[model samples]
Target: MAGEEGKIDPMHQFEIQPIFDGGFEIAGQTINFTNSALWMILTFITLWIFMLGGMKREIIPGRWQVMVESMSNFVTNMLTSNVGEAGRKYVPYVFSLFMFILFANILGMLPIGVIGLHPFTVTSHIAITGILAVLSFSIVLIVGFWKHGLHFFSLFVPHGTPLPMVPFIAVIEFISFMIRPFSLGLRLFVAMTAGHVLLKVLGGFVINSTNAGAGYGALVGIPSFMLMVGISALELLVAVIQAYVFALLTSLYINDAENLH
Candidate 1:
């Protein structure tokens, strides 16, 4: 989504434009359905189709079923390793979270832009990722208090601390704990946004150079196209890794809540 009268506007892709003519007002705010929301809905539908493939549990699994099962097992293993048997109860939630993010990231990287289609990366927006991070953190808080009550605050205090250092350490840990959701969300937002911007900029180079002249195209356009291809591959890798990191960290945080470690 870079071309605008032969000029490139990389950030144009991230803009949230209303798809509907009007929106219902809540309080003083009018919330309109946007392209971002549309893409999110599309991502959900795509994910549903993908999961539906694995729904039929034949005696011998098909390739689609195996692929889905492999992703499920991957997330389940991640949860189990991070949180032990306690994590088993959380497999469904964490797996859904991981798959949604993975799909959203991959959907944004689709090359359909060449066909005049714009794909939005939901996770590129801090608001969306922040909500997800807050949700995960909320679960941790709920589980911690539900199980440990006042003892849950002890999470800020590590074991075997001397009395003098306890107060200072708890303050630092409290600050750190409070920052978790913000940091978690910012990490994903920055990664996705930065990657898309870089790709768009390089794509601009490829397009402009190719149109300028054959010599310029040979010198600049081909290299930029090649680099874009490589970065696209890395972006795909990052999409998967970020999803895993989000799920893994959520499971680890839950582990801390469940075990008070």
Candidate 2:
């Protein structure tokens, strides 16, 4: 009976109205700040503090150092297991990507309204994810070519494939490689956007039903609240998983380019 529209708009929960408007005279470019920018800035600052604070070389590990080390080790192991020892060189970029996404995801969970600001999520923006995906893809492309030269193209051709199927296989491989950026970006964007929308819709239903003095509203509201809590926890996990997956896949692609296997 609730959420009967079967479609919920999560954008309503966050205020995305533009705060500044400026047009560049030389380049003919327009720039404006929005709630999304505020959240992104917050995410960046949070990441900087957490990471920079723990960057000191300590003989005995502090809590912050241990936290940083754990995350680094996690990415290191993931890379080594998937891409071997040669992949260690990519740990810095991979770790940076993971920390950025992790911070964005966690910050979005906070109630920004408490600080008198709009609650906008970085992951909800396709453009943001697209940019990150492009960066990752670019790194993979550059590193692949740098490490293997023209041999990187050989990744499209499988060694065991028959000659007749080579052209078709190569085309498919190329297309799939090209699609990686869009696929990776869209997956994170859609998942975060959809989860937030679901929570907002459920919260709205509970509030409206309660105002109407509907006796059943309490039952529905309680469960809806619980569902929201569960989703928040799940989103935290999804955030880390998405980042790890992105880094892991990038390493794998690099490995393919290097070994041509």
Candidate 3:
């Protein structure tokens, strides 16, 4: 049991478990809800509770109210800057995306794994991120075509390119546009997965060190613990940054589609 207790499986943390086994089915397909769904719902609810609870008419805002306002303004500024005046209409969707991702990333960093809890991060799964990316990309596509019609295709073709290079450049642009969803999703998935794995490795070392008794364990364990502390801080920064980057990139994509430059 000691040997088993010392064992660590980093990838095991990403596994998805159904919340209800005997879930409903549709057309012979088992439609079971999962931890990912649960967490996503929780993230949304958390965002709503914070925002709703914080909103009140006051001369001086409280901490939660200030945070809510700050977060709203931050995302609003990002969209307005990147996507311009037209982006105001999209503030709702973009803000929700930002909040969901930010919360999910933070949730992933919780040390529930050490306590034998079935912790999970939905953003760690490519399926979740991929769907989000695709949805964002689809919105861009639909809006672009709706506003610009066939001229939206001009997005792939450069304005001042020579005839000979036009085809090649257009092909390259097409490929890059097509890869947006893939890249966006993969970026989030990889960041969450890799960060957790590294944290788990260091965490496991900490636990294993304690099991090894004293003596040399202290020499190795102290440094690992310190490094883990640093890593945890860095991970928190990364979680916030990744969410910002995702939203920023998405805003830029929207700009590209809208103006077709």
* Superposed model 3: Cα runs more than 4 Å off: 1-5, 57-60, 113-116
Relative to the true structure, candidate 2 has a C-alpha RMSD (angstroms) of 3.6
The global Cα lDDT (0 to 1) of model 3 is 0.85
* True-vs-predicted CA distance for residue 63, candidate 1, Å: 1.3
TM-scores of all candidate predictions against the true structure: 0.95, 0.87, 0.92
Write the residue-wise lDDT of candidate 1 on 109-204 in tens digits. Answer: 898877888889999999999999999999999999999999999999999999999999999999999998988898899999999999999988
Per-candidate local distance difference test: 0.92, 0.77, 0.85
Q: Give candidate 1 misplaced runs (Cα > 4 Å).
A: 1-5
Model 2 misplaced stretches (Cα beyond 4 Å): 1-9, 20-26, 114-116
Cα displacement (angstroms), candidate 3, residue 201, comes to 1.0
Query: Per-residue alpha-carbon lDDT of model 2 for 1-261, expressed as tens digits?
Result: 132454435567554656677523446644557768778898889988988867896989899999988888998997788788977887888888878877887788676555775567787778888998888888778877988898888888888899999999999999999999899788878877877777677767667656657676776777877887887788778767776776777777667755568
- Which 10 consecutive positions of candidate 1 have the poorest summed lDDT? 1-10
Worst 10 residues of 2 by lDDT: 1-10
How many clashing residue pairs, candidate 3?
A: 0
lDDT of 2 at 166: 95
Name the best candidate (by lDDT).
1
Listed per candidate, the RMSD to the true structure in angstroms reads 1.5, 3.6, 2.2
Please estimate how well model 1 matches the true structure, expressed as its whole-model Cα lDDT.
0.92
